[model samples]
Target: MKKKINPSREWYVLYVKSRHERKIEALLKENNIETFLPLVKTVREWSDRKKIIESPLFPSYLFVKIDFRKESEKVLAIRGFCFFVRFGTEFAKIQEHEINSIKLLMEIDASMEVENNHIQPQVGELRKIEIGALGGLGCEIIKVNNENKIIVRIDSINQNILATIPSSYLTQLATV
Candidate 1:
């Protein structure tokens, strides 16, 4: 059966191997596939010196939007490029709002306000932080947007891209 997907296709998450996110993304782009990788810049320091690095906001995962024919050879070839996130025999579909939230975060690079489930910045409100430390964990927020940093950061080193709490977490110290 030919796989059918409509126009205005939403983003899909792929399960590429750890450390392959950037390369697979590059390969997909080389093949004209639309992809999005949310990233942030942070200064990494060592005894020698400090360096600014641009890193993926979500580690080990990248988003792609494309229509594939189920029986098409390219689809399988793309799958063979790396591991595909699966639910039994299917590539798992990433939640739309999650991707939206990330894009929204990337767009803003200034102070943001956090109240309830919303993150308000000079640009606009992005996806509501419905889960995790900002929402799901049910702890008092440390801060909203800390210097354009996505703290309580994520590790790109693994395919899971799990969130890690910062040693000095965000907290609402004062208000305007």
Candidate 2:
């Protein structure tokens, strides 16, 4: 049996056209719809010079907070607005805590890279940070370039955030 979702405002992911994330975000906000487009600054280099640019962390995707039954059609009608991300027939809903996690990540300004969720076989066990900035955040240890890295998977968006962390801050979680 399918589980019933709460009929209140919840976070949903929307897939938009390539490189149009910011524009769509503006349009959605103009319509009074709450949206979150997480962006990160990166330095881009060219033959002439280097310039810093802000780009969406999750390219081609953004999160919208809405009551799906009432506001979905309004969202869908906007220009460059695409359909909501889905798992089977149901919309993929993001938990409030997950959104807060992303917000915290942005606030910390950690050096990290986003990877597509085509994760390889686990090399190490699941662990959580015991101290420091990301304390209490659960992550899996993965071996990359002969070094261990902490990978946090955001399942709703099919992305993994890999950050360089010292082993001393890690505490193994008890397996059920």
Q: TM-score: which candidate is best?
A: 2
In model 1, the runs with Cα more than 4 Å from the true position are: 1-5, 70-80, 110-176
Tens digits of per-residue lDDT for model 2 on 1-176? Answer: 98455559899999999999999999999998889998888899999999999998889989999998899999998999877998998888887777887787678766544343333324677887665556677888887443457787777777777776556666778778
Q: What lDDT tens digits, residue by residue, belong to model 1 across residues 1-176?
A: 97565565655566667767778778787776768888877799999999999787766767777664432234346643555556567655555554554565566542344333333332221222343334322123333443322332221222322232331333332343
Local distance difference test scores for all models:
0.50, 0.79
State which candidate has the highest lDDT: 2
Candidate 1, residue 53: CA error in Å? 0.7
Worst 10-residue stretch by lDDT in candidate 2? 112-121
